[model samples]
Target: MNDNDKQQGPDNGGSNPWMKNLLIWVGIFLALAVFVTIFNGPAQPAATSTIAYSAFLDKVEAGNVRDVNVAGEVISGTLKDGSKFRTYAMVQDPELTPSLRKNGVVITAKPEDGPPIWQYLLMQSLPFLLMLGLAFFILRQMQKNSGSGAMGFGKSRAKMLTQREGKVTFDDVAGIDEAREELQEIVEFLKDPTKFARLGGKIPKGALLVGSPGTGKTLLARAIAGEAGVPFFTISGSDFVEMFVGVGASRVRDMFEQAKKSAPCIVFIDEIDAVGRHRGAGLGNGNDEREQTLNQLLVEMDGFEANEGIIIIAATNRPDVLDPALLRPGRFDRRVTVPLPDIEGRVKIIEVHMKKVPIAPDVDARTIARGTPGMSGADLANLVNEAALMAARLGKRLVAMAQFETAKDRVIMGTEWKSLVMTDDEKRMTAYHEAGHALVRIHEPASDPIHKATIIPRGGALGMVVSLPERDSYSYHRDKMYADLATVMGGRVAEQLIFGYDKVSSGASGDIKQATKLARAMVMQWGMSDKLGPLQYEEQQGETFLGYSQTQRHNMSNETALMIDSEIRALVDGGLARATEVLTKHIDQLHLIAGALLEYETLTGDEIKRLASGQDIGRIDSDMKGPSVPAGGTSIPKTRRPKGPFGSPAPQGA
Candidate 1:
């Protein structure tokens, strides 16, 4: 602590804060006493009425007057029936006293022609005093919030995090373990810089966390704050910018000044790409306002005037567009990649979220995690919350496996639309279409296991067939890509075979679009085309950030472009031919699965397998079998209608 700080103590504005408060209250009490004394007078009578001067004289002559209090020329009085009245006499009433005396009415006169000298002085000075008090209060506020007052746009808006509610530690965070590990050293450096300084290893000036949105970058930063036990200042890069020029740069300077004051602290700037994008990327000069802000940030991070104890931690999903100067060795010496959680990380995340909710015994973290590939920590948290809401909606005390399934389905397949009515023929066609996808996926060795297939409308699709990976696949092989292409084309191929090409509906538009894109990626980018010779013939169609896209160089001629187009077409057609062959061979099994879907409207992978092998899956014909329930069970299909007055489920099969 500095000598000045130690000498001042915590008294702030005075030597003794309690004594200062006592004096303030004393002043307020004296002011209130004076104000009341100056304004105090006789209270107004109940229900006083204003009457004309002639009526007042008539009341007096009729002997209806009870009593009156007169102040100056204004008269207020009550009648014999206990009603009150008041009136102003513009001129002197010489006969009023005579009439009152004759009628035996009690009269009290109060001379209010002018106020006392002291009261008059107070009344006129009270307004000025109020204005002075307001001015004093404003002055006090200005002194405290000097740099952050109105017209102080240059002041930094960074908030100092308090360790109260919503505080997070390392134990609170799950997934992105790699990024968390990379940031732990930052916490160590903040807690005890001597641990590293002795070894000649000064901590990095800044660490940049690069990740996809919702991948827990901010959580990692919060964890550091919780562990470091030091001042933590958080601000967004967008907060530094303003409508006026030079404001963003000034804010950057003020923010660094704050961080330096609380040395050995952590400053987290979220979405730094907002102000640190590549200079001149936009339609402006190099010295634009945002560019100036970026320049200031760059200098403060690694300038001649050292920021010895301030460690900067910036998080952005768009690291590709950030200025290169911000990523130099003296600035962001470490780049931590917080990728989407893998299977194990996903299980940990699910378990972390599960702790916050009431989970039934039926809930399995591994099962949920295995089904959710590439979900970020935020996504898993949302999934758990949705499941809890679903359970609450059903009045269930705990979030069971059923709610989790519904939540996952809602996230993956989009929202279910049970009210979407389709004709029997349309339903049958959709069943056949999805059945083909399920059958193809099952037959392809390289394909992932089919999780579920339903002819029920969800999102924009009349039917959906979802496949879940056994484990998260890091990279796609040629065989897997081919299998994906065939699976995507299965619906279209099925429609063409059953409802001839001439009668095929445009329901396969999505499938066609997906297939075309995948095939193009494979041939043009993945080098899966023999003609393309295992080389990237086009831009990678990779992450586009900051509205920046690489200008397509004419690396290939028009002939090569045609070849690329042909290669993409060939790949797609090959997938279609493969699907056609597979469906042709399993036409009988295809018919069986389609019939099952027509009756049930949805089937899980296990159910499809059991039914395809000729097992009854809860069919109402006194034949079908389902493991979840018995035949004619309470479990109802999506498309079933009421057959009787009691709303019994339909027994008819399409």
Candidate 2:
């Protein structure tokens, strides 16, 4: 038989064979008992005779007799005291006749001769037969305990998948072009081992797939196995460990042996870091068990003999925490990183997942990909399924673009908080707060384009202004950084501009924290402050308990720390001043947008643009219906100082 038949045979060998044998043995034993009972009929008398004695007073009793025989129910016999006893016709009552009560009679007589030799032998061997049966039972139990029993604990837990079982090929995995290309070579090597060996080249000992969870590392490994048409042994690292001490090492050895036997095989270990954590890193009496397992794994990976035709592939998100020995050149050899997909990669992933789904013609995967920047392949798949489910819930025949959009919003934010209660004053404050962000983004030329603004509460946010880049960008410029900071501070600036020092809520806590971090990084880390002299004041110090220490702490004096703090504060103050000036100039337009927001509860970027430009509020244009803007129209400008910091240009728009 082929390898597939062999693997399947072993999987079913233990239980199926045992059951068949057990049933056959049980049938045999039952048949033997039945045959023995049928052949061995009721006991028969050798001679007919009768014996009699008084049950109460048996000093002497007499009856007729016949031939002397051991199997006879009644026989000629004499009492031990030399009294005579007839073996037959001793009873006159019908109930006491020999034919009526055959074995019920008790005679106080001894036979002239002892029982027959065969009967004596049968009686003597009873204890030996019982002893033999007991010994057989113990031997059977011992045999069961030796093999296919508790001793089978040393068996490997890896599941063997033959060529026909793992049907997933490289075609199924999408959006990981580079990873796929690298893995394709491994598959080629597995298929044609001699091609690489002829050139004195050694196949990589192992390849570790490093990525965040749900990035399809395991899937890629399976695809490689499918492409190579080899036996795939799939297991997790945790399967190697048990409560016992040596079990994990034994399991590792057994797994490697099995893989070696099944040559041209791929051993896929998911979450390898579970068994390969950094040695001697634990605090309380180092974990000897895990360390032992890791040592065994290292030996198995790179021992005296090279593992030809046997390839090991492991996946882990926490590759950084793995032991250094496992990652050395001769062991893991190669590490492939699978990061979150870019826009194009996300589009490919969406397309791969959407093939099974019935989607509307207008449902654009590219648009969905552009909206979801940091989503992984798994996330895109989930998004597609979620969109399909939303369509089904709405009783649509196919998933539409609107459903995908809603799913994107649900994934980014959360479900709509329709039941959340809010007073009119709170709603107005939220509208103004959101309007502040929108207006600031519109006026700041370097800021990303505003997509939409809403006073409707979602994901616990009372209101939000969504701004997105026209295209996906990898790098951020300094002007964009400054503009982002201005947008972050817009709400506070608007509150101060309109209410003139009225009560301000702590709703901007996250905004303040982010803006502060960015401003501090600009000064101390990025060296945006000219006074700092382009020095990196932030020291990373390699994953310390607390955050990185500032360079000024150890090297500089208290006066220097004071100077650094002052510089940082000055930088942030300048950004806040710019935000204030812009908000103050556009105060009228801000109020108008805020009023419109309070009435409509939501607004697109075009509506805000028209209101800011002092256009009459007549019919809503088609572009204003959504977030689209008029072609070639520039956004409103930020308030600029005329000559110096003292005098500035007044806001021109409504």
Candidate 3:
């Protein structure tokens, strides 16, 4: 439809004739009143002439007075010619009556009274009465809507979604295969509780979905309700707590009462950690309202029977802080870890999101999944949406692989800061720094393969080097850790070699910080130090909730701490020394790669490999501003088997 047609909806002016006419007449009356008031200003009092008492008596004597009226403190009279005049007089004036009578003028006396009671009521009291009535109505409405005041704070605020409205199903969830499997039994129990009852088995009271944000915990709860065709009541943990003391406990009781009435349903409390935190946490009020709510929840969950079929599913990322009583055997019996998707799971998630968008044939899901290694299900879904948005912005018919690549980079490294420009000198330094990272990772025996290297500014980094493991490795070996540390320091080493130490910039600050952290973790937490004799120096704190505890505490003695610092430094120095040695041997290749980067700004793995290979075997280009060896000058000799900084034999190419 056209714009005009769309704007003309069914509820237009002509739909109700009386209402329309009423509005029109109201507008006309307002406009007329405003015009009169603006043009005429305020009303003027009636014109009257004031005459002195002697002149009034003279007029009466001359037979010019026609009539006189005495009312309260004033006496007024009209002349024989009908010209009106009035004057004030004392009530005790005896001449007032005699003068009028002698002149044969009509005289009348009237009692004085105030204005009518209804007039006063209308003019002064009506607006206040109307305001009081409106205030009463609003207060009543607030009481009805919130169902809370001095006495009614126990009502539950959960929204009930019937089976038909529970639109999500298992088919809608992806990338969380383990969590899905764990919930399938809950669905079956809701569908046919008799099967379990006959076997003398009781289903678990509840399942707690624990994971980082965006791992699809709440979505899985809805799918269970949809799959079982049961009623779903969802509420947030904060909803149970209130400013009043007993309100939260009352809400807990009311919610369970309602759920039991609608038995064979699901109660999903999202972010349960808000109300389920441990009692006496040494923060805030000792008698916290949240603690009371948690106590009530524990009581209700324990009272419910397995046969009741009112499954409670709670989701929280901070299960570490939940009260232990709430997570006991009878309540929240199942703990499901909905972890971030692996490579294969990411591919499936991408495919699920891709089904709705128009995409080019070259948009490979596998490649995208490989690039997004640590992404959760929601992250992958957002990645697809970002790609589609990019395509639409560029006015493309379909989302292409190029858009996905850019979108991935935007998510991983942040959006490119095209406005952030650098001088030629800065650009050259960034290229060489990134090139150093790629070269070291390429030659390091235990390092992952380099994915891409770029000197373009993205987010806070002036350059980036991406490396992806060929396959997922659950455990890190000592050699691999050393290799990773050396790779991190490669950028700094590269800057020091390409430009003298004085010319090096702070771009390697992040690289140095990461390398230091890894070294410290290795010595103190991972027990990788030979001097420390594989004894863990760090103590772990208690898990806040869900029992997923593992934070390091440095509780060692002063002497031990000193030993740890020395060990960390030893590890970092060793990695840097190895990186420096390898770079020195491949200094020619490093300059050549950096030169190529200056011209291209970015390079893929294949291009990097080709550039590094080109400089080998004395294939020298004299025009290039790099080290040129004479006929007899050699490069690494290819047979000088020496240990790399990671204490492993360097790769043959290096």
Candidate 4:
């Protein structure tokens, strides 16, 4: 630690964070108190000079009243001697007025006067004013949450970032070097436009970043603005569209006008597919809010001059769905594809993310990258974060290699279902099933190595066998596909040999589905089938709007479809037969592996190989002697069963 950090004490020099918030709340409370005190004023004393009814009548007859004012049942007046008094009189006193006039006292009769003008106005208008204020507050809250209100429908909701707002330069981004290089030209042009102008070159109007989700498209756009030290205006495609037709167009104009004002600036539109979809697609109703907005956007792009300093950058995962005009040369002139990071790219990404974490010395970023084959940039970031969180949860000071491994498994295979319960028979079956897969994968030279085997329930699996390649493979071969099929069928074959056909569980349903898909792909897509020849039988039509292929059709006849199905079935059956033969030859190893699984619950590849090798050494003596002669030599002798997962005696061959 540095000396300044070490010398720091509890009484720090910086301002307290709570001081500002506390002052704001205190001011609000004081204002509310003052408002309440002003509205509810102090109380007044009662008048003590009120005379009785008879006394009031007597005084009216005696000419003591100089002037009398009758307001409701009370009479208020000034006496002749300049003394003021008030008295109560009944409404039935008809002679009171006459008596006052006979005594020569001036009398007037009128209704009671109301309160002061200020108080009166306050009573009548306060409710309406409060209601209006509440309505305005509610409208503003709605605008904040929904991004638009009745009055603000045409206002641009673009988020403006000053030059200092986003400090993310090119150095902050990694894993997509090609995309960075493609954007470097724009950065240079933005920094010094005279160099490009001298060469008679015009900067591209817009650049569209296309990639899968979590591929760092938005981050790269921000980096471009950051490196150039220019203002960045960001908005989502959905921000332009509204329920009203013209509002979308108005918002587009406002956004462009803002971009123009902040010249030498960049505007980023995220998820542009929401507003830039293909026009007249069969999807929406006849109303064209999105189309009108897109039209306005096109006009604004075309209206800009060559030397105008504004540049637009848009991001979308589905570029195929955008309007054709948006992709034209004058609009989005450049297209940059940000694909998923490869092995080396992943290693770089991991290194960048690891800087934020207190990682252990043994945590090899390159090893972690190799373990994660198909992960994107965002996925790797989340994996690192998840590892840190796991380490923190365990009360560890540093994020270790084991934590990263656990995090990778959690991201790929899902959280372990530790609470799931299984019976002894089911657990035994799961053990044998997983062990079958391990044996086939270990023996097959073409298949990837088995990394892990576990009978623990996770996600939708009662048991799992994971195979990881030694290195990343970009292409697949027919031999590898066949080996994969055999590995998939191994579990079912083991169940059939051990517990008979009826006792086999339905846990292999996923395995069968995957095996069938591979088999069909071989026949229809890969054209690796001997009977089907080297012709494509199925065609995948491109999506009309914005989606995956709408449908796949078989161009061949129904008879040919039958043949394809037959070929798929033949491939599966052949895989099953091959798996049975391998399992039978290493039947002792399979039994030994299953027993190990029931004891350990999970096994690494190295542990499985060690156990299998030890069992092979013991079986060499038995293999030298010819087996007891059988008619077909297909059946094998069964060994004594060990204790099952739930401590029950299992069947002999189980």
Candidate 5:
């Protein structure tokens, strides 16, 4: 198998391969030293002979011929009573002779010869052998520590998927039509390379899949692999980092080399922004390791002589922070945006998941899709699974529409906190607060009608009023902003109208804060304020991290800040007044709705409509029955009107 196909093993404790190999070599040298020492032979003596002076004393004892001649191998002088003699001699049945002429000397014969060949060899080789042993030990340690024998830092960390592993095709991925179309060409290039070559066109070296989390970016990459029928290599950006410097860069090189060997293969890097951040943008001298890795990646993308049929696919949500070099023409040539699925996309996603579930005849995918706006494919899949689980919990044979509806609500709102205890006074106050919002929305000729209202505590709120548009809308006009502000202020206005004072609580704090911010932005930032003229006080770029730094605008007088504040307050006050006016005109209607809420603790949009028309609560006793007629069959007032521009009043009770 190629280096890319080799699965990464656990770290071998050492930071570098040289260190590990150094340790191994040291161990081998030590083992060899112990073996040689155990098997070495014993020492031997030298063969040279020694001279003997005792022969001269023996000749004196023999007393041969008055004076004995002493002849030795190099006698220095004649011996006297107190004199010394220096000579090399050997006693071989020799009689010491004293010279009769002038000086008499006793002589002993001496032998001269060198040591044996074995002794010479031992003396000469001993020092050389010790030096050789020391040299071998040092070399082994150096080799182990240097890691020159192993691939070391150049190993790739990418994961390889073989044919045994299940593949993911386009059929496995649902939703995101635009992204699929963009990636289809990549798959085509991998499947049939000559097709692009014929046109003298090169396949895009890389494609960046940008989206929020759980939008199926990684899944799309796998689908490309399956479509092309090529090997798939997967790794995270974090895998490249190591304690040792330059390891990340080395890993990048190894990964590219592996990809080249397995020609026409895909390399999928998930969350690549972890290591591919913009260079020279970090604090201090900057992260050396990450920068080096990014530099190596640049080389692999466009610096190499040829890519050799290798395609790199990277996924990240924060594409804005990536290095510009990484996104250049020859590198990430195409950027595919995978946004949250719209209504129709959600329907298809739900249908894909529903096939595995036993859905009842009444269950409708389109209805569920409409109910869940701005849901990603992952969210839709979870919804379907949740619905099926709910049906199973109730011991039902199949998933019903009600189950899916309840699942949708559960996903949006928290689970039903039915056991949450509240005093009668608190419940009454909640009813008035929610009724205030409902009544203002229903009465305003420009406000969108309410879809549902409930005083039952759910998802930490004591009450909720859900206002949904009849159809999806993209842009908002001035009147719509005014209507939205009025709806937000309706609760506070109702409290003051009914109780003659405002009792503030944490529940309405978020609403009040959001409404005030929007109003201020409309005046200061959006130039929606009439008195402020057409100046944009705040500049917003729709960045995820908002307001990273403050810029000094051209100095303005204190009067300007005060004027902006006054304009914002004036705008919000107008909305509050409008809400109060609408609620006052329908005060009796508000009381009827609040009374129904106190009894049922919840009410649908239809129930609120009947109550607003002054219909008696006794006539609408059943939940399923249509609005009831009075005992004398009196017709209710048709106060509901069609909505205007900016989500204006759509006629109620339609």
Candidate 6:
């Protein structure tokens, strides 16, 4: 933000300069009232004491009264002794004035003394005027909080950042480099339109940013504001609609009008799908507030009167549900997908956030980035922040690689829940379950490399086995899918084999859920079922503008449903049988790995392999302290996104 933004002045915040000046005027008027009361007050009687009327008459008879002025009162006079005193007289005292004249008193008559016309008016209206001003002030403040003067519902809620907490220029943004480049070119063209116009090139009227959450879509828009020396308006799509019927359309019109005023500006509408959803999804009456708002917006963007010099930048994660008209060539023609950053991009993101913390010389961002696959730019930033916090908690001088490793685990799995204590039998059962998953994965040739195996409780899982893909894959092959299913099922199989059929605990609940999801997606969505014969068997739930209570029905007949169910059951049963066979053949190796886990509580893939090979893992007595965050197994749910080529280590468990 530049001085221009700062110069917009504080809005709905701090003290209003106009209000401050009004208060000063109020103070000035109050001081004037005090002065008027002091100078334009009733004239004093010039008397010290009240004397009886008879005494005044006696004084007049004795000729003690020298001069008197009857102001419809007794009189005011100075005695011959040069001492002044005053006394009240009867209003209908006809003898008073005559007595004064007979006594040879000097009679004086003058107009009554009072304040001037302007001063009198000022004093009288001061209270009413102050009250009126205070009422106006209260209304004005309420208008600021409520909306444009009392009925501000029609005014645009699109907010212009009067002042940003900190400026975010293009230089600070990292990862999503391609998306950044696209936005930068737009800002560059805006900075000098003639430069690009020389080639008969016109900048796109709108650019839609499509990305997963935390992929820096909004941040890219803000960076545009920082790079371009033009006005930037921001508003959420949800802000346009209200309960009032015509309010949303009015807001759309008002917002565009404002943009027209600030031409050559960027207006960023966040979550545009909220209002730009497929029109027919709402009330079919066609007069729905959100639909009307969308219609107005569509018209304003590319309608009869072209909104020249205005650019709309909108961000949304769910672009599939947007209306067709909203995505046409004339409006939102440039679609920029901010994909999850690849490993190199992730390393760069880490480096950017690392600059804010004190880092040790040995800290390698690439190592951390490699370990933390599928992390978006926002996630990487959080990782750095978490690492710094972890170091601080440990009272370390600087953040170390060890802290980053711990932080990555914490972000993915969760911090170590040290409070839960397990009996020896329970711990052994957990070890066998995790070892079964690891061994099953190792046997599957197409499966990813085992990253680690741990029996330590993390999140809601007693133990977990994790895998590390050498490179990211867009789609899974059948062999790898089977491997995943078998590995997840291994826990239950191992429990059945070692602890007997009835002794299996609920520790395999997550494993069963993961396997079911994988197998269902394979049979229904991926067409991996041979009996389904590559036919689509399941349809998605009804499309919703919002999560309304839409009925979810299966169009398939009961026999077809039975076949689909049988197919899913067969796949799961096969996975379980395969796991059971693998464990039965490798019983000795299973006990070996479980023994290592029981001793050390956690083991990396390399250590587990060493145990299986009967190699001396001589570091047993040294550096065996568990990490602050429970190191997760690779069996965590992997991200299915086609881009990024990174792994997802969610809280998937054995």
lDDT of residue 348 for candidate 4: 93
lDDT of each: 0.79, 0.71, 0.79, 0.79, 0.72, 0.77
Model 2: ten consecutive residues of lowest lDDT? 645-654
lDDT of 4 by residue, 1-654 (tens): 431232233237545847854665586566556446546663323532666778777776776878888888888877777776777766667776667778898878887565678866765676576567557756865775554646678878998775434478887789899999999999999888998999899889999999999989989999998888777889999888888989989988888887777677899999998888877773678458888888888898999975888889999998878889999998999999999988889999999999999999999998888788889999999999999999999999999999998898789777766556566677778878988999998988999987778776656676788877778888889889888889999998999889998888776787888899889888888788899898777776756554566546466788899999999999998889889999999887787777666655667787778777862212222333543222222222332223333432222110
Per-prediction TM-score, please?
0.79, 0.73, 0.75, 0.80, 0.69, 0.80
Candidate 2 Cα misplacement greater than 4 A, ranges? 1-153, 162-166, 284-287, 304-307, 541-557, 614-654
| lDDT accuracy of residue 136 in candidate 1 | 73
- Better by TM-score, candidate 4 or 3: 4
Error of 4 at 430 (Å): 0.7
Which residue runs does candidate 1 get wrong by more than 4 Å?
A: 1-147, 303-308, 540-555, 614-638, 641-654
Which digits, one per residue and each the tens of the lDDT, describe model 3 over residues 253-332?
Answer: 88998888777789999999989987877366767787878888999999989998899999999876888888889999
Q: How well is each residue in 531-643 modelled by candidate 5, as lDDT tens digits?
A: 77888776534223331434233356789888888988888888889988989988877777776666566677777887778655454545435654432232223212222
Q: Tens digit of lDDT per residue, candidate 1, span 1-654?
A: 742343234336565756765776687678877777677744455587789988988888999989988897889878999998988899988888888988999989976446767778887797689668757756655645635644667889898775643668988888777778888888888777888888778778888999999999888888897887666789998998888899998998889888777676789999999999888776676778898899898877766222277888899998878878888898889999989999999998899888889999989999999899978899899999999999999999999999999999888777866555566677777878888888888889999998888876666676788888898888899999899888888887887888897967777777888889888888767788887888876673433544856635347789988988899899899989999999999887777788777766678888877766656554353344434333222222455632223221111111
lDDT of the structure predicted as candidate 6: 0.77
Query: Residue 310 error for model 1, in Å?
Result: 2.0
Q: Which ten residues in a row have the lowest lDDT in candidate 3?
A: 645-654
Against the true structure, candidate 5 reaches a TM-score of: 0.69
Query: 1 or 6, which is superior by lDDT?
Result: 1
- The candidate 4 region of ten consecutive residues with least summed lDDT is 645-654
Candidate 2 clashes between residue pairs 3 or more apart in a chain or in different chains: 50-87, 50-88, 63-86, 64-87, 64-88
Task: Compute the lDDT for candidate 2.
Answer: 0.71
2 against 3, candidate with superior lDDT: 3
